[model samples]
Target: MTKDLLMWDETLFRDPEVFEIDYVPEQFNHRETQMRELAFQIRPGARGGRPLNTICRGLPGTGKTTSVRKLFAEIEAETKKLVPVYVNCEIDNTKFAVFAQIYRKLSGHLPPASGTSFKQVFDAIARILQKEEIVLLVTLDDANYLLYENEINRVLYALLRSHESYPGTRIGVIAIISDMNVDLSREVDPRVASVFRPTEIYFPPYSADEARHILTERVMSGLYPGVLSDAMLDLVVEQTMKSGDLRVGLDLLKRAALNAEKDARKKIEEDDICLAYQVSKYLHLSFTLRTLKDEEKVLLKTIADMSSEGKEMNAGEVYTHAKEVMKIGYTRFYEIVKKLDAMRLINLDYRQGRGRTRVITLRYEPQRVLDLLA
Candidate 1:
């Protein structure tokens, strides 16, 4: 057997960080229209005025968060008058947690984790913004998570109406919702909806050609020349299009290269791409599962186990099993099912039995879900 092994010091990656999910590329392509609209809404804050509240709606990996991050970077570089604070609602889904993020951003330290009340934290954030005469531009990425916890209304109400309570506190919100099924107008409270009349920006999935161009750009910037051939790159692009997520394509490129390296090969092959996809395809699911609470994970695991055994459990049946493991009411179980459905991890369908019974099904293979959960 002949093998072309790389030197211990040599690496195919020119910059491995480029393939990271959170690494924002310097040259963002194919979303010029959305970026321009986002900048326009945020322009006022940059110029020392209150920025307009905005809604950025799109599917997962559609560049909603990236656009906001890129624009926020530019805004911060331009002036200190506009403070851009990014809150990931996936991790900070509660009102106190959300404000604590802003508090940390403004004050350069987090509020006392256990002792600080939400009102105290909110007031401190408001006072700092008002005192500094700074406009607060906050991007709530994955704001849908807040909607799931029923905290969206409170968060929005507080942010939008802060000026009413603490006069001269300028704050604007850019709520990024990846779940297209979420309608803010219907989901938020009437008071929040009234004030959060935002400029809506939609990010559609990239076209096949666009995906090809973007993936090719990453190939050139992230990997060494000749490491990924055109044919292999096309295969990666096809897989990315199938997933409808650019992150998957990036992960595929990185994973395929690693697979090639492990085999003592300088170049990635079709087999490398195929093997990498086995894990990369679940990138979204993996991320979603990470954000879930412990109880939520228990419920999903129960459903996955039953589904793996060819058991189609309805909401009540799954609730019965799930509650056995975790103490939760049926209403909470139903909400978890809906939240999981919105996250695209499961299919929540209503089948007409005695009444309209909710049938639970795993969106991915049951084994795959169980393996990931494990």
Candidate 2:
């Protein structure tokens, strides 16, 4: 019976990888304008001139990373003069690690992990670019991580202002972030910040129609024909629209397909989609909450406790409660709460109307958040 249970069903997935977040479609819908603008910026490098730096800012799952990667593929295909090297700042968060990434991309080998000064790594990068006579188009994905870790200024100086030290080598930066209000003037040196006058390109979240279109495309490629019903697809699209995250839709699609496959069914039923939605929400919340620092977790605990009775909280109420649990000042508490809001863990509204004192709402269910913390 066990063997029969494992052996009996027809599969629905033609290529499961198509549902992955990193999958690059041949035709990227709703992002053509931004791609064209980025291509134009790097156009000068093909003629041996320095390209203007750019900042690609948008909410998460808005296709910023995918678009840059697709552009890199295009640049590599068409140009021999420009070399595109992409790095995720969350992993390569320091100046030394970032330079090591550039080095590996250019030379096909990593520099010794330690005992190599940053100056040595930078010099090696300078020598390689100068020798190859090739321009470097460096992309820092999740760039706000660097700023939060206080590593952005040194990295910026190394990339944007390196031409001063090397002479005749061109390096362009494409900094990607989810936050739109990241100001470099406050963190970086004035000289380096001046050189990095980035042309900002914003990627807005998808509307319901756009989300449905994207889901349709994914379903066609990822699952067998007629596996997912149009009504079921609409349900997934609606859920994603509420979240404003495309990944949520893709996750739902993948999970629902898996659920269908698990029950030896050829078609995805509505119940499968509903189960997938709940599972995906729980997984996302757990993953995010686990990444927060202890202090941030404590703040989340305070919010969860205060809102346990299903009451909406204001900034002052949380502030007063958090003070008793943690010995933090008001200003610092406000900053941390705003950071949580930026992370989409909570909703913070500052209104100028009467009787409104910075309303705060926990975006996730309070009990669910507490369970995850435990």
Candidate 3:
């Protein structure tokens, strides 16, 4: 007789939230060095002084955000003098919107949606900090978004140099940059750079063993016992390391469990993992693409289309094709190519042929990129 299928009410997850993208695990392993360094930099804020500014550089899923969140939680639990605010720059990319987040965090309400100038918001936040004697520590998660929008200088200038305009205002910033190619020091304005100097903390990609240990921990906490076999766990880790992202492992685990459940099986099998990886491996690519501007997306598509002919296109050839779809000049096209390379969407290489020609190539399968763009 056939085994009974999983009922609608049956689930393999013990705590499904543990597999979520934003879930901060209780045991954050393999990042102790980064956490300690971050804490040391932020220690001053706990004692009513401005926290040292920090720049967290790492690839996607390298525990940077989780480290900041974990530290922020510890800070809030330990002190009243320091107020920690985490602003996702992807959502709040403007100077006004950033300060508005600060305002909301301090005052327990948002500023008026209209009729409030940036100066007004800045002054209000400054007054609150000065009056309360509270040290403000803001974490600009995904801060590269601010740099792209040309608001990094304005945001950093106001936060780092606020004391010049309003005496006794203590503020610090933690800028998290996921793009390892970006040099934060070279990207900011000189005046802002002078004060915005930060303690650079690098969170390198996890080693294979570390990735295995972390994923095993997640499986134990997130799923029921006997749901995933040892062999399948190794498969998930291998795929995750291949992608160089831990989130892909977590996603693969969750998806594989679901696939098992769909088959009314208590344990995940190799087929489950193989199928889940088909989608999980591209998690980082999908997220990075979502943040690209229209022009950037168009340029990427153009490259993908050109590369489908099975030849690596040089910079000049790419610009010629890109300009037809977008009204950008060669200089701007070159910039976009560099940005895409930084984002890991494409490979940018310089060849010694004819005065250092730039070679462009897509990182993923051209058809996969085209399908996603569609």
The C-alpha TM-scores of every prediction are 0.97, 0.80, 0.88
Clash pairs, model 3 backbone: none
Tens-place lDDT per residue, model 2, 246-351, is: 9888988999989988987778889998999886656557656766778889999999888788887889989999989998999889888877886678999987
lDDT of 1 by residue, 1-374 (tens): 34456777678899999899898999999899999999899888877888999999988888999999999888878799999999999999999999999999999999997977888998888888878898998899999999988899999999999989999988899999988889876788788889898989999999989999988988899998999988988899899999999999999999999998887777898999999999999998889999999888898899888898897778888888887899998888888888888888889988997989888888888888888888
By TM-score, is 2 or 3 better?
A: 3
Q: Please count the clashing residue pairs in each candidate, in the order shown.
A: 0, 0, 0
Candidate 2 at residue 61, lDDT?
81
Model 2 weakest 10-residue run by lDDT? 1-10
Candidate 1's C-alpha lDDT?
0.90
TM-score for predicted model 1 compared with the true structure: 0.97
RMSD (CA, Å), each prediction: 1.5, 4.5, 2.7
- The model with the greater lDDT, 2 or 3, is 3
Worst 10 residues of 3 by lDDT: 1-10
TM-score of 3: 0.88
The regions of model 1 sitting more than 4 angstroms off are: 1-3
